[model samples]
Target: MVRTQDLTYSYDARHILQFPDMHCAAGEHWLLLGQSGSGKTTLLHLLGGLLSPHGGFVEVASTRLNNLSASELDHFRGQHIGIIFQQPHFVQSLTVEENLLLAHQLAGFRPERRRAHELLAHLHIGHKSNVRPNRLSQGEQQRLAIARAIINRPKLVLADEPTSALDDHNCEEVLALLEREAGQVGATLLIVTHDGRLKDRFHHRIFLQSTQA
Candidate 1:
């Protein structure tokens, strides 16, 4: 469901980071491991079409991301890619359910309250569905982030530093939840992290070296 070839990017033309070719079949899980400045996040953004690559190509679900217009890319990403950032971001003015509904609407799909509620219930945050995101606890917020990311049943799920802030137990729980949820939807999952604990959990792993070095 995801593939990249000769992907390269740079900020100011001094250091161009080139990534190794990658291919992940549908529903497969992967670990993208790299140290700081290794371009792990850059590759994730390129795959999601958040940043245009300087060279090569990113294909997600068979679509060439580099060829899409900004608007088209936004639509395609919203519909096909679900991203879990290191920090949870949400619409402060909207309730948890509303925020998820917004995700549907933004993706050009009709808002489905039933789907939002179902996801919240599945994540054990159904009670907080009407509450503002800021009112939730840290763990609840993390679960909510997972819910939002998979709310659309996206084809690809990319998580960035998802376990960075958690204790070992919470980290395990989070990873389990992420995998289970993505698997439930048959979505391919890729997690980008520096954490070594995950190295043993996933069978398919890619370790990236800093191109600058």
Candidate 2:
């Protein structure tokens, strides 16, 4: 569902990252391991269409990101790629449910209350649906980010440092939640993290260092 070809990214003419080639099949779950400044997050942004490549092609679900206009790319991103950013970014003014609902509403998809409730319930936070994100615990908010990421039922789920802040139990919780969400919708799960321990949990490992140009 996600692939890149000879991707080279840079900032201020300094090459920050490069991918000779990469690919992941639909429903594949991959753990991306790299050191700090190893381009893990940059690669995730490229996969999720948040960053345009300075070179080579990137395709998500057969749609070439380089070919799309800004508006079209935004629409494509919303409709197909779900991203779990390193931080849990939520609008403080909106309730937890509202924050998630807004994500779907932006994509021209009516929020499926049943699915949202189910997701929240599965994550053990259904009762807090009406509360603002700030009122929730750190764990609750992290789970909420997972909820929001999968709310649109995207074809590809890109996670960045998802397990960084979690305990052993919460790490398992988050990973399982992502597994279930990706499995339920047949989306590919591509997680980017510096930790090597994640390799044990996932069957497929994409060690980014190996793909460096």
Q: lDDT of each prediction vs. the true structure?
A: 0.92, 0.85
Query: After aligning candidate 2 to the native by TM-score, how far in Å is the CA of 115 from where it should be?
Result: 1.9
- TM-score of each candidate structure, all chains considered together: 0.97, 0.95
Off by over 4 Å in 1: none
lDDT (10s digit) by residue, model 1, range 1-213: 899998889987788989999999999999999998898889889888899999899999999998898999999999999999888889999999999999989988899999999999988999999999999877778888998889899999999989888889879988999999999999999999999999999999999999762
Alpha carbon lDDT at 11, candidate 1:
87
Per-residue accuracy of model 2 over 1-213 as CA lDDT, tens digit each: 788898988865645577648788999998888888778888888888888999998998988999999999999998888888777889899998889888888877987878888888988999999999999987888899988888888999999999888888888888888898889888999999986557788888877673343
Write out the backbone clash pairs for model 1. none
Clash counts for all predictions: 0, 0
- For model 2, the stretches where C-alpha displacement exceeds 4 angstroms are 210-213
Weakest lDDT window of 10 consecutive positions for candidate 1: 136-145
* Number of the top-ranking candidate, with lDDT as the measure: 1
